[model samples]
Target: MKIKAINGVKDILSDEIVYWQKIEKTARDIFRRFGINEIRLPILEKTELFARSIGEATDIVEKEMYTFVDKGITMRPEITASLLRAYVEHGLQVRQPIQRLFSIGPVFRHERPQKGRQRQFHQVDVEVIGAQEPQVDAELMAMGQMLLNELNLDVSLEINSLGCPECRPDFRKKLIAYLHERHDSLCDDCKRRIEKNPLRVLDCKQQGCRAMVQEAPSIVDNLCSACEEHFAAVRKQLDRLEVSYTLNRFMVRGLDYYNRTTFEFLTTDLGAQAAVAAGGRYDGLVEQLGGPKNTPGIGFAMGMERLCLLMQQQEGQQEEQGGADIFIAALGEQAIAFAAPFVHQLRKLGLQAAMDYSNRSLKAQMKQAGRLKAGFTLIIGEQELEQGRGILRNMDTQEQNEFSLQEGAAMLAEVIAPDKA
Candidate 1:
């Protein structure tokens, strides 16, 4: 019998790791620019935290989350709930009136994997907790725009308001009335969800269900005066900032927590997995989850896999598979003995240098160097070691030259690192 990786989880292998590193670095730099502090939360949390915050009726809680009934814990399906849990547990509001926090980590679910959707995926989550102003919502969306723009990705932003506890009920009533009129026409999943979670039906992908929802009333039309005012303020700020956005009535997030504002960064390239990032305001969530009442916050989480997918589709966008800077091919016993310290000195000078550890034949070592895509290969033979010199070969041009072994760094710098030279 053979062992294999779990069906839906995949490995980030060597050649592909550089791209992941680049994505993480870009997120960190952009996040830093916004003064968002990085937060590290545990992958496992009390199951009740999410069930209470994300709502038991949502797909994540009822169908997708990886719950552990016996241990009373569950792997987090998203970071927002966990972040909120941390905020309450640590009493973050007391430390600062507002906190801008971000996290980049893996999240787990039990769904079948597809091209851009994985059972175990990663997300870059950004949250601004404790602010009730619509300007913060506009800034959050703008920052998302900037991050994707920096990545050279083509994506569009769409936003909707989910009307808070004060207003969502009337919209919910209207939504349910419309959904009931066409309940039989909807898919079974949607038919079941309409009564318990009508907002979920609006996001259904089933063709028949989507057609049925097209005629249903939008929450925007049913928002109470307060919600309407808040929604208007948010759009006004976004307009002032020149951040273009579409008003997507059907873009209600799949969580029960969201209210007042819900937005997503979408791309058409990935079929059903269209949203690269999505989030919203959850004014009632902190109080709902046993924190200070009326606490307001907004956030967004970008799927790393989907972002990478869109990144791969962009024209002229190259995958950065960083190769070795220098390879020291040590031949003969004396040359092999001289390899370690020689490579160390090159590295101390900031060169990514490596040498043969097994002391393979010169031909074999040279082949390895070529395989590694090293820019330059240094050949140190017995005679060269005795003479305190080594031959440097340009792997690309196959041009050969010599330099003092004691001056290996300076010699390599002349051709490869001219600035250092």
Candidate 2:
């Protein structure tokens, strides 16, 4: 019998790390340019935090969250609730009236794993707290667009407004009534969603449920006067920024906190996981979680795994293995002792250097240098030690130059340095 990883989780091997690093690097650069600071949060929090923020009736809270019932703690299934909790507890609001923050890390969920979705997945979450203006929503969506564009991903932006509490009750009532008429045909999930969370029916992926809601009341049309104006302003800002988007009347977020200005970046490349990134405005969430009242917020999250998958799917996206600046091949014990210290010297001078510690044959070491794609190889042997010089061969051109052992590391560092070259 062999020990194996958990069924729903995945081990990200080194060869696949390049794609992940690219995604994270591009996201961090984008976030920096947008003035968003990075934040780190714990992987676990009180179960009530999610129950209060994600809605107790939602599938995430009811089925997916990995909760320790006795401890009342859960491995966070999402970043927003824990982030908000930190915001309130640390008095981040008092420090800065408005916060522009982002976090990148893994989150947990106890759901069936699929290609781009695992039990433990990573996300780059961005949030702006205490900013209620429609421009905030537009800019946030624009930032998401910029990030995906930089990543060279083929994703489209879709926007929707869930409407604020002022007018949502009436719309919820109407939506519930519309769902009731098709009660017999609704999927089991949507059927139950009617009374507890009618808005979620519009977000269902079931073919029958999707068809049923095509003619259902559009939440965009029923927005209250304030929400209508706010949504219009958001669209106007998006137009000013020249950000292309399509209106998705049926787009409703799964979380309870979302209201008005919802959006997602979707790509057809990923089959069932069409959304590569998604989020929306949650005006009352901070207050609901014990923060200051009326603190408006909006943010979005990009799935790292999905982004990496898309990167891998793209033709010519493979990352070339980086080569060492220099490789030293030492023939025997004396040469090994001399080459070892010289390798460290090159590294301290900001150069990538590699040398075999296994004391392998010169031919084997040369092969290792080729595999590493080393730019140059310095061959040191007992004869060379006696002669006080070594042969430096350019791996690419096979041109050999006499390297003086008297000057040693300093002269070698200058000779190999790109700027010096």
Candidate 3:
């Protein structure tokens, strides 16, 4: 029997790695500018962490999590739960009143794959902890916007509030009662949620569930005084920063720990999986995960694969492959001996340089140079090696010139240097 990769997973080959590198570099540069340091959390966590934070009734916790018992400990499906665990156990004790943390790594979800959605996906996550102030929310959103803007991705921001615990209980009761009236019209999952987790009914993506909840009561309308005030402050801060957004009353995050502010950075270009990024305030998450009380926080996570897909679609092109600045083609045994040191000298001067190791003929070496997309080709034949000189051909313009070995290296270095070039 031939073994193959499991379904819903795919390999990232060399040709596609440049796009990933570009996106990660852009994210890292933007995050650094915003004063958010990178934090790496383990891929696995105690399964109970997600159960308490993401909630037992949600799709992620119920159907998608890759949970397993390992030597009496349960492993988790995703990294966000681990992120929260790290923040509470280790980050909280630090003196910093506010911590800005970012992470980029793989997360597992057992969903059927399509287009950009995968069973194993990567996420770029950012979290701001120990700050209940609405400005922190605005700042977090701003950092996301900055990253998108830097990438030149045309995306829209959708904002909502899930009301704090003080008001959500009443809202859940009203929502459940409304769903009970339309119980016969709901899908089986929504029907089950009506009793177990009434709030989840609003998050269903099924056509029938969507239609049934069109007139359902919004959590925004039932916000408690404090929750309403916090939401208002968040909006006011966003307005002051001139961040454009749509008020999406139905945008309840999948996590149960979220409170007050919730958001999703969406793009219609990605088909049904339109959300490129999504997250919210989880003020109660710390306490839920056996840590401090009332430690409010907000953050967001972007699917790197989804972002790359969107970028490819929006740009209508793939990133051009990077190549060496020069290719040294040797013609004979003597030329080969001379070319080795010359190529190393070019590289030491900070120029991308490469030479054929297979000892092919002159014509074949030239062809290989072209295939490598080398900007310039240095032809070191017997005559040139005898004279300590070589022929340089500009691959782009097909212009040929002759120079001594040392002179050619100096000229290439000059072209690469700012002042001399």
**Any runs in candidate 1 off by more than 4 Å, and if so which?**
408-415, 418-421
The clash number for model 3 is: 0
Which candidate number would show the highest lDDT if scored against the true structure?
A: 2
Kindly list the per-residue Cα lDDT of model 3 for residues 1-421, writing each as its tens digit: 9998889788988878877888899999988888888888776677777777788888887788776756323444555667779877885547687888889998888999899998888889888888899888988897888888888899999999999878999999999999999989999998998978787788888999998898999999999999899889999999998899999998887777788899999999987898999988988887778767777778889999998887788874468678768898988788888788878877777778889867788789888888888988888889997787788888889999876776766676675333433
Clashing residue pairs, backbone N/CA/C < 3 A, model 3: none
- Which pairs clash in model 2? none
Each model's lDDT? 0.88, 0.92, 0.83
Relative to the true structure, candidate 2 has a C-alpha RMSD (angstroms) of 1.4
Q: How would you encode candidate 2's per-residue C-alpha lDDT over 1-421 as one tens digit per residue?
A: 9999999888999788878888888988988998999989999899999999999999999889999999999999999998999999998999999999999999999888898899999999999999999999999999999988888888999999999888899999999988899999999998888899888889899999888899999989999999999999999999999999999999999999999999999999889999999999999999999989999999988899999898889766777657898999999999999999999988888888999988899899999999998999999999999998999999999999999988878788778775633
Better of 1 and 2 by TM-score: 2
As a whole number from 0 to 100, the lDDT of residue 334 in candidate 2 is 94
- RMSD, one per candidate, in order: 1.8, 1.4, 2.1
